[model samples]
Target: MPTSRELREVKAHFYSLAGFPNVIGCVDGTHIPIQSCGGDEAELFRNRKGYFSINVQVVCDANLLIRDIDARWHGSAHDSTVYHNSFLRARLDNNEIDGHLLGDSAYPCGRYMMTPILNTSTNAERLYNVAQIKTRNTIERTFGVWKRRFPCLSQKLRIKLEHTLAVIIATAVLHNIAIQQNDTVSIDNSPEEDIISAESNMQPLTSEGNHYRRLLLEQYFM
Candidate 1:
């Protein structure tokens, strides 16, 4: 496990990247399929498709150093629900996290977290969306690196759910270490990726979510 100070340092360094401020890091959850363990224990890990799996939530900075992670739940749950019940909830509720979080549309728009809408047309929003897309790419890239480096994550894990979290966290810690060494972590990218379509699903925040996001953005932007 990383010391709290080390985690904070990683968080601060990643958020310091250009155009990113007060950012605790980018947060996302990935599905990790697990082998059946049998009995009631088996049902808890079984997902919608009857496949045993766990949802791993990770928060990483601009450099892809994971600062915080939560990986104990089954994959049948929704990402938003996991986040709502996560430690992120406490940090967000107390206004402890500094900058807005980046995530895919699986998460809804809210203060301290931003996701592109399904439709947006204004020029300013367009520009803002562009920057978000660029920054959020770092997390996806990190995931690719993680799956590649630890082939165990690319396929079904034979370990029990409890043990799986430990393995994932250990891998995250090592990933950050490798990044510090200036390792090459690459993900396949199309030559002509369209930023607009990539972010097209972004929607305006609802009154509550929008007001909260604006307040957080203002606090950091200022």
Candidate 2:
């Protein structure tokens, strides 16, 4: 485990290079299945998918370099709830983050975490969503690179859940190094496919509910 000082240094350096002032990083949770391990510890690994796994929470900077991460929770825990229970909550409460972190709708919007819910109908709301999408893409892209580069993350590993977290962190640090070193990186997306994907994922909204959601999001983000 990295000492507190070392961890702090890493986070500071990461945010500095990322050029996002006061940003603690983008936070999200993912489930990683683990093979059967007997006892109460094993119980913590069960997920809503009816699989055994651990919930991994990561905080990455604007540059997509992980500043801090936690992976001790059971897969069954909600991501938002996990954030509340994790050290990240203390960091946010203590004002350790310069600005609120960006997250997906799975997490509720808070002073410490900014999330966008499809609650808008105004032209202004449309603009805000566009802006949010642009910034939020960074985190999604980072996850893509992280998972692709770390094949072990895509498959089951022999290590204990706790030990596996260390491996994950080490991988994140290495990913940062590659990004810092100016390594070749490419992102792929087809405009047509993207449109289709978005259409499939979009939720329908009632006129009144849409208006309210749009107004609420505008007020909150503004």
Q: Highest lDDT among the candidates is held by which one?
A: 1
RMSD of each: 5.0, 7.2
Collision count of model 1: 8
What are the per-residue Cα lDDT tens digits for candidate 1 across 8-120? Answer: 66556655554544456677777777888787766776665556778777777767677678887876666676787898778777966555687777677877677754455
Q: How do the residues 1-222 of candidate 2 rate in per-residue lDDT, one tens digit apiece? A: 223455455445434442322334566776666776778677667776677766777776566676667877776776777787888789668865445566666665566665555756567566556655555556666766777677677567678655877887788889889888876466553121111122222323335434644454556444
- Each model's lDDT comes to 0.66, 0.61
Q: Lowest summed-lDDT stretch of 10 residues in model 2?
A: 190-199
Off by over 4 Å in 2: 1-24, 185-222
* TM match of model 2 to true structure: 0.71
Worst lDDT run of 10 residues, candidate 1, spans 191-200
